[model samples]
Target: MVAVVTKRYQILQYVSWMEPVGRRSLADQMHVSERIMRTDIDFLRQQGLLDSSKSGVVLTARGRDVFTSMDQFMNEMLGVQDSEKQLAERLGIDHVLIVPGDADQSARVLDDMGTALAQTMQVMLPLGEQIIAVMGGTTLARAASRMNFQLSAGRELTFVPARGGVGETVAIQANSVAAAMAQSTGGTYRVLYIPENVSEETYQPLLNEPSVKEVLALIDKSSVVIHSVGEALAMAERRRMSDDILQLLRDHHAVAEAFGTFFDAAGNVVYKIPKIGLRIKDLDQIPYVFAIAGGQSKAQAIQAYMQHAPKQTWLITDAGAAQSILMG
Candidate 1:
C-alpha cells in the first residue's frame, strides 16, 4: 500500500511538471511499462485527479490542489525538509532549498532545479517597479528558462545582465540569459556589450560608454540578483584564461567561481576578473540574491562561494550538492 501511494505521488508530480504529457512519454520517463502506466492512469482518472485526452493528460482542478499539497508532503517524506533547514544552518546562509536527485547523474534534475527556482521567485518577488540583475552560466540559463510569463503579471520588473560577456558560449552568456529571462517573464532587459576579461587600459574606456553605463546603473539599483556558482578550474579553462592566471588560481587553491570572482575553500578571494557590472560587494545592498548551482561535483565550489556570500543571499541547490556538503 505504501508502495502504491509512492507511485501515485510520483505520477502526479511528473504530470504537474510536464503537463499535457502523453502516456507513453510519461511511462518512458518513469521507466515503467505502458501496461502499468495505464493502470495508474485509470486509477487517477477514477479519482478525478487527472483528465486525459487524445493529445495528452493534465491535472484537474482537484488534482492541481492535491499535487500542490503533495509536494510538501513528499518533501517531508523524502527528508528534504529537514535537510533544507540543516543546510541553511550549517552554511550560515539566509535560506536553502533542495530538490530531489543528483544533477550530476541526470539532466532532468537540472530542469527540476529550474522549476524550483521559478516557484521560489513567485513567492519572494515583491510588487511594484523592480530591477533584477542576473549572471549567466549553463545552470542559470536552464533555470531562467523555466520562469513563466505570469512572473511579471503584478510587478514592473526589468532584467539586466550582471556583467559583460566572458567569452563563454553565446547561449549561456550573461546578456543572453538576461534576454531570455526577460522574454520568459514578460519583462524588459538591458545588455552590457563590453568584454568581461578587459585590460586596465581598456576598462575605463568601455565603462564610460553610454550603453555600458546605462546597464551598469540598472545592475547597481537591482532589487534582486540571480546567479550561479561554477567550479574554479573549469571556469578558468572555459574562459580560456592565460597560463599565468590559471597558475595563480591553482596556487591559491581556488575552488569556486561566481560573477568573475574566484575563491578558495576558505572563501578568500583568489582572483577577480576585470570587467564592468555588479561586484561581489554590491550584493550587500541588494535585497534578494539567488545563487543556484547543483550536481555533486559542485559541492566544494558552492561551499567556497557561499562563504563569501552576503547575508541576504538565498541558495537553491540539489540533493546531490547539499548531501555532499552535509557529509563533509
Candidate 2:
C-alpha cells in the first residue's frame, strides 16, 4: 500500500514538472522500466488524475487540485512550517513563507516557491493605482509566469523595471520581467533601457532623458517592490564581470547581490553598480517589498541580503533554502 502511494505520488510529481514528456522519458527520469512504470501511468489516467494524450501527460483540473492540496501537508510533514518560523526569528524578517522541497534538488520546487510568491502578491497588492517595481533574475521570471492573475482583475497595476539589465539574458532582464508580469495581469509596464553597469558620467545624463524620466518617475512611486537575491560571485559570473570587479567583490567578502549592490555577511555595501534605477536604500520608501528566492545554494545570499531588507519585506522561499539557512 505504501509502495502504491509512493508510486502514485512520483507519477504526479514527475508529470507536474516535466509535462508533455513521453512515457519512456518519464521512465528514464524515474529510473524505472516503461513496462513497470506503465502500471502507474495507467492508474493515474484511469483515475482521471492525469490527461494522457499524444501530446503527452498533463494534470487535469482535479489532478492539479489534488497536487496543490498537498502543499501544506507536505510542508508540515517536512517540518517546513517550523523552519519558516525559525527563519523569520533568526533573520529578523516579519514574515517568511516556505514551500515544500528544495529547489536545488528538484526543479519543480522553484515553480512551487514562485507560485507561493505570486499568490501572496495577488493578495497584498493594493486596490488602486499600484505601481510595482520588479528586479530581474531567473527566480523572478518564474514568479512572473506562475502568476494566476485571477484576483488582479479590475485592479490598476503598473510594472516598472527596478534596475537596468544589460548583460543578462532578455528573458531575465528587469524590463522583460516587468513586461511579463504586466502582461499576465493585463496591466501597464514601463522599461528602463540602460545597461546595468555604467560609469557615473554615463548614468547621470541617461537618467535625464525623457523616456528614462518617465520610467524613473514610476519606479519612484512604486508601492510594491519585488526582487530576487543572488550570490555575489554567481551574479558576477552571470554578468560576465571584469577580473578587477570580481576581485574587488571577493576582497570585500561580498556574499549577496541585489538591486545592483553587493553586500557582505555583515550587510554592509561592498560594491555598487551605477545602474540607473532603484537602489537598495530606496526600498525603505516602498511600503510592500517582496523578496522571492529559493534553492539551498542561495541560502547565504538570501541571509546576507535580508539584513538590509526593509522592515516591510516579505520573504518567500522554499524549504531547501530555509533549512540550509538555519543549518548555517
Candidate 3:
C-alpha cells in the first residue's frame, strides 16, 4: 500500500512538471510500461485530478492543490524531515532543506531544487530593501531560472554577482546568473566583469575602477547571500587554473571550493583564489546565508565546506547528498 501511494505521488509530481505530456513519453521517463501508466492515468482522470485534451493530460485546479500538499505529505512519509534535522545537526548548520531525489540522476530534480530556493526566499526575505549576493555555477543558474516575479513583487531587491567571472561557460558565470535572476524576479542587478582570479599587480588597479567599486560596495552591504559549493579539483580545473595552483590544491588535500575559498576535509582554508567580492568570513555579518549544492558525488565536498561554514548558514540540498553524508 505504501509503495502504491509513493508511485502515485511520483506520477502526480512528474505530471505537474510535464503537463500536456503523452502517456508514452511519461512512461518512458518513469521507466514503466504504457499499459501500467494508462491505468494510473485513468484512475487520476476518474478522480477528477487530471483532464485529457487533444494535446495531452493536464492537472485540474484541484489536482494542482493536491500536488502541492501531496509533496509535503510524501516528504514527511519518506523520512525527509528526519533527514533534514539529522543532517543539519551533524553538519553544525543552522538549518538544512533536503528535497526529494538525486539531482545528478534527473534534470527535473535540479529544477525542483531551484523551485525550492525561490520558495525559501519568499519566506525568509524581510520587508524593505535588500541586496542578495549570488555566486555562479550551473546549480545557481538553474535556481535563478526558476525565480518568478512573485519573489520580488513587494520587496525592494537587488541582485549582484558575488564574484567576478571565471573561465566558465558564459551562461553560468556570476554576471549571467545575477542578470537572469534579476530579470526573472523583477529586481535590478550589478555586474562585475573582472576575472575571478587576478594577479597582485592588477588587483588594486581593478579595485579602484569606479564600476568595480560600486558593485563591491553593494556586495559588502548585501543582507542575503546565495552560493554553491564545488569539488575543489573540479572547480580549479573549470577555472583553468595554472598548473602550479592546481598542484597546490592537490598538495593541500583541498576537498571543496565555495566563493573564492578552498577547504580541505578538516575545513581548513587550503587556498584562497584572488577575487573581488564576498569572502567566506564576510558571511558572519549577513543575516541570511544560503549555500546550495547537491548530488551523491558532492557529499564529501559539501561535508568538508560546511565544517567551516558560518553558524547562520542554511544549506539547501537534495536527498542524494544528505543521505550520502549521513549514512557514511
Candidate 4:
C-alpha cells in the first residue's frame, strides 16, 4: 500500500494544487503520456482518491488529506532538511542549502542549485544601496542566468565583478557574470578589465588607471560577495596557468582554489597569483558572503575552502556534496 501511494504521490499532489485541471494538462506537466497516466489515474479513482470528469480531475477529501500528510515525507525522501542541518554544523557556516542530486551527474541539479542561490540572495540582501561583488565561474554564470527579476523590485543594487578575470573564458568571466546578473535583476553593474593573473610589475600600473580604481572602490564598498570555489587542479587548468605553476600546485597538494589563491585541505595558502581583486581577508568586512557550489566532485574543495571561510558565509550546495562531507 505504501509503495502504491508513493508511486502515484506526485500525481495526487499536482492534482491537488491544480484542481479541475484536465488529465491532458496533468500528463503534460508530469512529462508522461496519457496512456501511461491512465493506469495510475484509474487506480486512484477506484480507490476514492481522485475524480476525473469531462471538465477535469480533482482530489477527493481523503486524497487532499493524504497529499498534505505526505508533504514533509516528500522533502524527507530527498533528505534535504537533514543534509542542510548536518552540513552547516560541520562546516560552521551560518546557513546551508542542500538541493538533491549530484550536480556533476545531472545538469538539472546545477539548474536547481542556481535557483536555490537566487532565493538565498533574495533573503540575505539587506535594505538600502547594495554593492554585490561577484566572482567568475561556470556555477556563478548559471546563477546569473536564473536570477529573478523580482530580486530588483523595490531595491537599489549595483553589481561589480569581484576581480579581474582575463584569464578565463568570456562567458564565465566575472565581468560577464556581473553584467548578466544586473540585467536579469533590472539593476546596474561595473566591469573590471584587468588581467586576473598578472605579475607585480603589471599589477601596479593597472591600479593607476582611473576606471580600475573606481571599480576597486566599488568592490571595497560592496555589502555582499557572491562567489564559487573550485578544485585546485581544475581551476589552475581553467586559468591556463603555466606548467611550472601547475606543478607547484601538485607539489603543494593543493585541494582548493578561491580568489586566485590555492589552498591545501588544512586551508594553508599554497600559492597565490597576484590578481587585483577581492582578497580572502576582505570577506571579514562584508556582512554577507554567499559561496555557491555543488556536485560530489567539489566536496573536497568545498571542505578545504570552508576551513578558512568566514562564519557569516552562506553555503549553497547539493545533497551529493553534503553527504560526501558528512561521511568524512
Could you give candidate 3's per-residue lDDT for residues 1-328 as a string of tens digits? 2355567778878889999888898899889999999998887675556788889888988667657855764675467757777898999986777788887898777777787777666545655698999999999999998888766745788999988778898999989999999999899999999875678788869889999999999999999999999999999999898899999999999999998789998888998888778888899899989888999988999999998789878788888998899999
The residue-by-residue lDDT of candidate 2 on 65-157, one tens digit each, is 656755454444345556666888888877788887888888888787777776555434545678999998888888888765553544678
lDDT of 2 at 32: 92
The number of clashing residue pairs in each candidate reads: 0, 0, 0, 0
> Between 2 and 3, whose lDDT is larger?
3
TM-score of 4: 0.76
Model 2 gets an lDDT of 0.80
Regions of candidate 3 where Cα sits further than 4 Å from its true position: 1-79
Residue pairs in steric clash, candidate 4? Answer: none
Runs with alpha carbons beyond 4 Å of true place in candidate 4: 1-79
Q: Which model scores highest in TM-score?
A: 1
Residue 171 displacement (Å), model 4: 0.5
Off by over 4 Å in 2: 1-79
The global Cα lDDT (0 to 1) of model 4 is 0.82
Q: List, residue by residue over 155-273, the lDDT tens digit for candidate 1.
A: 78899998877889999999899899999989999888887676879888877788888888888889999999999999999989999999999999999999899999999999999
Q: Order the candidates by TM-score, highest first — what do you get?
A: 1, 3, 4, 2
Give Cα distance to truth, residue 242, candidate 2, Å: 0.9
Candidate 1 clashes between residue pairs 3 or more apart in a chain or in different chains:
none
